[model samples]
Every structure is written in C-alpha cells, then in structure tokens.
Target: MGSCASGTQVPKSTLRSGSRNPPFSTRPDLNLNTPWARSRSSWREEEPVTKPSRKLVGKCFCGAVRYEVADEFVYAANCHCSNCRRTTGSAFKPFAGIEREKFRLTTGDDRLLIFGEESGHDAHCGHCGSLLYSVVREGAYVHVAMGTLVDDPSIRPTAHIFVGSKAKWFTVTDDLPQYKGHVT
Candidate 1:
C-alpha cells in the first residue's frame, strides 16, 4: 500500500489492477536512469505545495440572507463614521473588505435590500433588517460586517477610519492606527 500526496492510503488492490500505470512511472521511452529523468523526479519532489483557500460563511441575524467568501479578506477595519454607526446602531462597525468577485450570495439573495446611493449602498436582510455589508468603490469591493460573520476570517481590524465623526461618549483604547478621516 502506498500513500498519495494527500496522505491517503491507497489500497493494494488498486495498485495491482494492472489496468493503470503505477505511481511515479514516467514515459516508457524516457530512460528512467537518465539525468533528465532524475532531475524531473527531483524537481517534482521539491515542488511547493499549497493549501486550498478557505470559504467563509456569513448570514444576517434572522438567517434570511446567507453568503460565502471564497478566500480571505483583503483588509479589515473599524469604521467610526456616523453613517456606519447609524446603520449598525453601534458606536463602531468592524468590517472586512473583500473583492466583489469572491463574495457569493449562497441563499436568500432575493431577501437582500440595498440602501443609500448608487456609488455605495448598504446591503441588509429585508426580512430582519440585519446589516450584511456595504458595497463601495463602485461595487469593486464589499465591506462585510464582521458581526454577521459566522466563521472566523483569521483577520482582525488593523485600523480605525473616520475617527473625526466617532461618538463622543465612546473611547478607542486600542493601539491601532486611527485616521481623522477616511484612509486614502
């Protein structure tokens, strides 16, 4: 029995079938003893392996809207702007920025409602009024509400934006960088 690259043990039955070529078998015409073949095998063994990207799931409070992100976030931030606070009903909103192409509405897409201008809009679950994300930069990116995330993104807020409009009653105690206005 031999193991595959994924460490799965292959049954001996499969290997002895004689219908398929055995693992590590090169072209019959190519001399396995040649330097070229040895170099090819060594190169194959040294090839870098990569893990598949993780998929993150998120949903509204009422579960009326569910979505998935194919990969990790491009960036994360805490927005202290009044608009975010008003929409989220919180002092600050932590969001993860992801490319639009990576975000997919897995379920309840029809239940989503968009508010605000065409250039930027806040998406929420129409059934529960749960804020999901804010589409900005002409829809190139989505600012996903971290609170709505059902899975850990493995990324945390690194900065605070729009601090000038932050609530006076709240104080940011973290050492993260803060920008008076939006970070350009």
Candidate 2:
C-alpha cells in the first residue's frame, strides 16, 4: 500500500513498489523502479563532476611552448653552477627534480630545443629561448626550471648547490643549506 503526495490512497500495484523516493511531488521519474530509481539521490549524477587539475603548468617566456608536470618532486635547489647561470643569464637557477616520466611537453614539440647530449641535456623553448628543464642522472630525471612554471608548485628550493662556482656579483642571503659542490 502507498499514499500519494496529497494523501490520496494508492494500491501498491499502482505505485513503483520498493521505490525509495517519497510519494512523488514533482519528480518526472519518481515513479519508476529502475536501478537508478532505487536511491533517492541517484538523479544527482545526471551531470558529470569535474575535479581541479593537480598537475602544474609551465610555459616559455613568449608562451611559445608549454608543459605539464606532476606536482610531486623528489628534490629542489638553487643551482649556482656556471652552466646553469649562463643558460638562465642569472646568478642562479631555481629548479625542481623529478623522474623524466612525470614531465611532459604539452605543446610546441616542434619548437622544443635540446642543448646537450642524450644522457644529459638542457631543454629549452626555441621560440623564446627559455631554459625549461634539464635531463640529468643518465636521462632518468629532469630538473625543471622553476621560473617557467605558471602554477604554484608543491615544492620550493630548499638548498643552494654548486656554490663554489657561484658568480662573485651575486650573494645568497637566504638561510638555506649551502653545498660547496653538487648534491649527490
């Protein structure tokens, strides 16, 4: 036995028996007894859900190239080596290291530039000449240029590396750990 929204008596056969929704007031499918009708709230799934992207986006200075990388990183540093300084034209380079598999070029593959050999190389944006990342550790890892990031990352530079080769014109004022050579 069942009752309609207005308290009118209805035989169980006239209603969708075992339907979980209350006596219908305005729902179109409220009387149907399909799988989705068993749960009163299943109708909410009619629209798809969208989650915010967790990966970080990076791009070249002229926006001619772009990439996406997982927010997770194994290490981060302020690199003061002469090579890094010259490539970036700065006193130091802020970079985050992660497995090469996690770093992907999302756009402008034709304009992508590789500056070194296969085992180790610097990835740059050919159009804007932006230093994007470095493939190191025998090509298993990549050190991403923090300057090219368009999204806030989960990690930040924690130490200064290769300080021995640091330019005399610049002085590190932060209290981060300083490594005389390179990090292992």
Candidate 3:
C-alpha cells in the first residue's frame, strides 16, 4: 500500500446513490479471467454514461491515495479464497466490479503501487500502505475493495467463490450462492 500526507477530493455528482441493495449474482456465471465476451472496443465506443448507481469513496491508509467511483457497480462479490484473504489480511474480501473507465483517481496516483498476483492485482497506496482497489485484469474493470471505501458500496455479495479453500474462522451467511472454486 502507498502512503501520503494529503489527499484530494472529487465532486459527488460523478457517482450515483441508492439504498436498495442490488443483486450481485448471475444465473449463468461467466468466466472472470477470460476476456469479456463483449468486444472491448465496441463497449468503450458505445458504452452509455449511466449515472453511478452507488457512491463509493476510497483512500489509502496514509490519506495519500484517494479515489471515487462514478458509476453503479455491475457486480459486487465476496471472495473467501485463500489468496484474497492472505493478500487483504482479512477474513473475506468484498469487491465491486465497475467499468475501468468509470474509476477515477482523485489524488495520490504517485503513491499508488500495483502488486500483481496470479489471481488479481492489488492497488494500494505506497506511502501509507492502504489498500485501495484490485484490478482483476487491466483495461476491463476494477474490483473496488469494500474495506477501503469511505462510502458503503451499497451492494451485497452475489456469491462466495473459492469456498473449498476458505479459512476456518470465516463463514459466509449471504446465502446468495456458493462456489467451491471460480464460478466464471
């Protein structure tokens, strides 16, 4: 994680807000690692600028890293996988997938260092060591780290992945759905 003494603030209008919890699960899951079936170029060119369904704010531990999500998350998920737990040092990781173009770094880009793992990349503040967001794959979408955000993601875990390797201390109660390993 990166560290910094100061942070920047972005306007709130960039994101959307809603209280109703959105569904995070999908009936027919898609492979997360594979390229999005939709053409990237076409999506970028034609993607509508919809208002952010939820407002989410995040910063690094040292206040150096700051960011805002300006669009409603397409999906929010919880992972109990060993790698996620180990990397986050938490029982579970709550993440929201938003379009990469919608994510904005309000400040502290210099402090942001990306640690790429086999599963995903951890984006954090290099100065304060605050974990910001994880980019599962570059140029696709961002997995907003639920813990790092200042505002509630306002979404629920659609499914729990890697349940077979989940730690003993943690238990998922959402009941949305459970996958022993990768669902998509």
TM agreement with the true structure for every prediction: 0.77, 0.72, 0.64
Give lDDT tens digits, candidate 2, residues 30-99: 5567675666456576657867648999999999889999998999999999999999999999999999
Predicted candidate 1 versus true structure: per-residue lDDT over 39-133, tens digit per residue? 99899999999888899999999898999986579899999999999999999999999888889999998998989776689998999999999
Candidate 2: regions farther than 4 A off: 1-53
- Please list all clashing residue pairs in model 1, or write none if there are none: none
Q: Pick the lDDT winner.
A: 2
Q: Which model, 2 or 3, shows the larger TM-score?
A: 2
Per-model C-alpha lDDT, please?
Answer: 0.87, 0.88, 0.72
Worst 10 residues of 1 by lDDT: 21-30
Collision count for each candidate, in order = 0, 0, 15
Position 57, candidate 1: lDDT: 95
lDDT of 3 by residue, 1-184 (tens): 2111222232334323452221222212334344664566567879898763565678766788889896478888778888788778888787888888788999988877788863567887888766678876645788888777887666766888888888997767665788898777
Residue pairs with backbone overlap in model 2:
none
